[model samples]
Target chain A: MSEPTSQPATQLPSRDAANWAKPVDGLKVGAISPEATNLNVEGKQLSGPLAGFGQMWQKTYRIRLSGADVTPEQVIKLWKENFPQFWPKGNRFFGGVGIEPGQVAVLNLAGPGGLNAPGGGPLISTGIMVIYADDESFSFMTPQGHMFAGMITFSAERAAETTCAQVQALVRASDPIYEIGFRLGLLKEEDRFWKYTLTALADFFGVHGAEPDLKIVLVDPKVQWAQAKNVWHNSAVRTGLYTLAAPVRWIRRLAK
Target chain B: MAPVKLDITTRKINAKTSILDIRGEVTGSAESILMAAYAEATAAGAQAIILNFGGLEYMNSSGIGLLVTMLIRIQREKQRLLAFGLSDHYRQIFDLTQLDKAIGIHPTEAAALAAAG
Candidate 1:
């Protein structure tokens, strides 16, 4: 869509790629960065997961669930509905990077996959993604900020009649030109993930009299996955990023 | 000057692999800390390395970008680099941004280290 923001000194992986498909419970992720950290702010800049930003932010999570029967498709569906919420710029999509027609899908909200606001704080991902489903492998540009951000992979193995979905999402980001999403786990703002996930588990099972032993390793922007989500039938007091107060204040502040 | 604390601690999973635990904010001077750690590991002749995000708290774009740089370098050296411990939010960011295609990530450091070796 946009011309190369900066001349990427760091080259790309030299191989062909394949598209991703939903599969089992496997997780893999890593980064690709630029040789230089500073971007020409006068020129365009980018950041977020799908981006190849050099340095802005990162968090990691690994989840394991064992039950009567589980399938990767079920997990992938849950992932698509719930997972997309955590993506950058809140739910928008650029079908495939070029300025091709029907390429951009601008989401109007903040908590999913599109920008939280119009002209500030929100991030833009810029990079190239090369996926290889046949080889059970994939790759893309890191430091996705100045170019593109995000890529998906899925691998499934059906043991008997059940399937475990093995998946990975990678990001290479850069600090945004705008100061939208940044927090320091301030004021024990870090403690909410445990409270949320545990409470959710208790309430869902208590209220519905239905028990799903879901162990979620939440790699919170602030807290550890040792606790957080599904288990907590609790309010999303804050988005995945932890906070003591409601984020309305922050969002309001961002708007102002 | 503050130490610009960039700590890279490695544990040998076996002969051909080491899991490098990178913590602290990968911003400002710390960015270089990660860079140095990666470079040293590559030079140390480790066949494969797993980057453990379990200990890290926050990382910005520059931080992620720097890792990509490390990935390219590692590939050149014929070494394998994998990642573990990323959260759902960060995972979505990477997925949408396509970072998954850049480096290898495993559910655990053991798998990543083992894959490269």
Candidate 2:
């Protein structure tokens, strides 16, 4: 045992500041798997919910691990380590190692009904930046060309005896084309994707057959016509063009 | 440390402006309270709403999301949203999330009021 001293506690900086990512001019991707196409991510500015064209929506998906005797910290540690493993098949998340603040992760997402682009590339090639991360939660903000302009936070919390894992998204379609996609079944696909992800997460904790609860609110119903120009940054079209030009690039390389 | 639940009280500054004095943490749980305060401000016929965050102790990404949600509602109602008293930490958060571009941030209550007019 040590004697208590009379020294005052040293002032510490805000804890939240350490957890948040520093501001970046634009997202830059680091190392990613060769199989993952790094399109629509580099040099793209982040677009939050206010920078979108369609109606704003808030979606919450949660699953309870009733019998799993795990703390929120434990759950979050595993979730962050194996984030990509829990996603639905055909969607590749090229996040190196683990999630951390300011890290940019590339995503190759399957289209509705697992459809691929004409050249067999993913239907969408986009990415997200980890904006905040801590012991019990982490958040990802999308780039401008992604389907939705917003952030999604994944967290775990203890309620009574059980621990609940949650993914809450506040988003709006990034452009008119994406808005039309959301209206035409993309929203349902997104819903299914999160439900599947949560179910998989539950299963990992030995909670088999757990059905995730979902709640969606149309936060704003009016579309922002001013954001219609955002279609120029559409990732889908850009990714398709890049894929189609693959052979030409190979031919040019051979000539050189 | 135990979290402090957010408390909001609306003060009418003038016929066209109302100030919402918010205390404690602004997290996901503060949604209903924050929205209710905004409703009260709008009901009082306030054309501009100012958020006073002088007493804010903590906030998270979810809190920023809630602000975006509230901003949409305010825009739909054709009301201006201004804020004062954000700490340097939260001001950086607003800048990082690009929210500062949408919601006007002022250094003091008087400055916010002047902008509201």
Candidate 3:
């Protein structure tokens, strides 16, 4: 287990650290380059007397997706129209069955703001990365929500003629609530955005596993994947720790 | 003073327990929505409360703390709190933190209501 002052992985294995919880090793991402993201946010459900605090979030979503065929402008439009739930006014934009990015929607975004958040529920700074174009992509900021700082970066390297892999990473410093969402899987709305973008790209690019919500298709070799999936997955996306090790029951079954 | 969006729905399935559909974030002033619901249920002398967690996407530490308070209130009222319609991963939180021992969490609204009755 991590000592009260020290981190886990730097000292103890993740498994051991999680079981004991003194701040096991911190999960680390590779030394990947991150670009700034621009995004707009609209805080949700704060109606009536509370509206004046302007607890509402307003901002645009920003991401820099780099690849041979992947243009930032095209991706933003597709995202706004297709997987808008992760963006502004989510409920109105996407199918009512799903959360739409909306005319200007936010997440469960319930907190009012801490001292940093405009009036004091939660504080947020939202933006996105700009590739070559400089002015495009949808993103914004808010007084409440995770993404204390949001920067979506997508860079591509030539992996193959038809299959150029991409890596997109968002650097978000989240509030404890946003952090807890990841621990609780309450951020399925956010996770869906990552899944939709990759699936849409795969469909457009004719790669393997065109499904939107599958677990391993983006990283699998069968498809023409994004060059930067890193932005799509990171601590910014989550604040707490998660584990993949099977439970003791599953481990015992495997032994059998 | 912040406005608390209060949304409550009740379906009478049996005499012992009832299901309360809650939408919106259960944080800040919004927490009163639950407190009122809990009071009303106990006043009605219901046996249990099956709080439908379908619309609630996330809960902050404050929100979680509020829930803990609700559990305490229910215990004081000689009533039970049965949470239902939770996602599997969320259900795991109850296990990971051992909250299931403190509160009754079920797979769906139906299961919660059944347990309440």
Candidate 4:
């Protein structure tokens, strides 16, 4: 693996610097919709692939808008502006009007088969921080209690004649319980979720019947046993307990 | 601006250490090349791998994802990954993504080699 001593002398560009989010110790959710619950998101540190317990996986879902005469930038513009609208029926993403760097968005995700909590909230309440964003692509990093520990990038690219919208996630189950769920077919649910989003996106561009291409790769098969303790901060468990305690809070409010 | 395709060259600095000089932008397209370079370094029995990002012009979020993928591979092989020559902007990207916690970042190539030692 030896190479000659010739190295390029190119002056690097720094234009993308402003596109990245500045460092923050923890995430803080801004104003969100009343429909979204902001539990398990505030003051949480971001978790990356290294902080996960399960085997790491990289999945890419893409759909080509063949009939739509839109550029990559145009696709990204609509995708970022109306990000949550493209989600599958039950999931909800509550963020600001537009996606940008350093933005924090809360998510209310349905359990299998679109199950909701007794309090009419989605089963899992987690969030993501927008770590990077640009015209062509934007990426979100999961918070500590999210289902997965890692980053997901949504991008649009000019592929030959058509524009291809892609969602790529490099993630691992955040804790043991989630790891078990992933092993027991939650992975397929995740696949269906993103693929549905892509199909919706294509439909939004007037291109119907678009089939999404899926690719899954096992990046690392070893699970980090040290991260098993992450289950303590699992959002699903916390959300369930919070829902169960809702009546106590209502009683306290009545007393006050 | 025209996109600069990623170019990588690997060189063994010592019996246990190898360095990959990364040039141009790192995006989804750079995956195969980057992985091939890492494979070469590991095939040479390198216990520590150093990344020289002096010539790197741009890297997006997908590029950051690639580094995480590479980090997983390095950890599986029980090898150390160190980097230097990152611009201040790129350094901040590492910090924001929390990749600095996993990969050691040094001020210079000599510093990275010393850390590898």
Clash numbers, per candidate: 103, 0, 69, 0
Q: lDDT for each of the candidates?
A: 0.38, 0.88, 0.38, 0.90
Worst 10 residues of 2 chain A by lDDT: A1-10
Position B111, candidate 1: lDDT? 61
Better of 3 and 4 by DockQ: 4
| Residue pair clashes in candidate 4 | none
Give the best candidate by DockQ: 4
Docking class of 4: medium
Runs in model 3 with CA error above 4 Å? A1-256, B1-6
Ranking by TM-score: 4, 2, 1, 3
Quote the positional error of residue A13 for candidate 4 in Å. 7.0
Candidates ranked by DockQ: 4, 2, 1, 3
lDDT score of residue A184 within candidate 1: 30
lDDT of 4 by residue, A32-111 (tens): 98878889899999998788999999999999999799989999999999999999878899999889999999999997
TM-score of 2: 0.92
On a 0 to 1 DockQ scale, where is model 4? Answer: 0.51
Cα lDDT tens digits, model 3, A13-129, are 211122111111121112222321112322211111111111111111222222336544454344444543332221122122211111222232222211222232112222211
DockQ of each candidate, alpha-carbon based: 0.06, 0.29, 0.01, 0.51
Per-model fnat list:
0.05, 0.41, 0.00, 0.57
What is the TM-score, restricted to chain A, for candidate 4? 0.94
Name model 2 segments beyond 4 Å from true.
A1-12, A118-120, B1-4
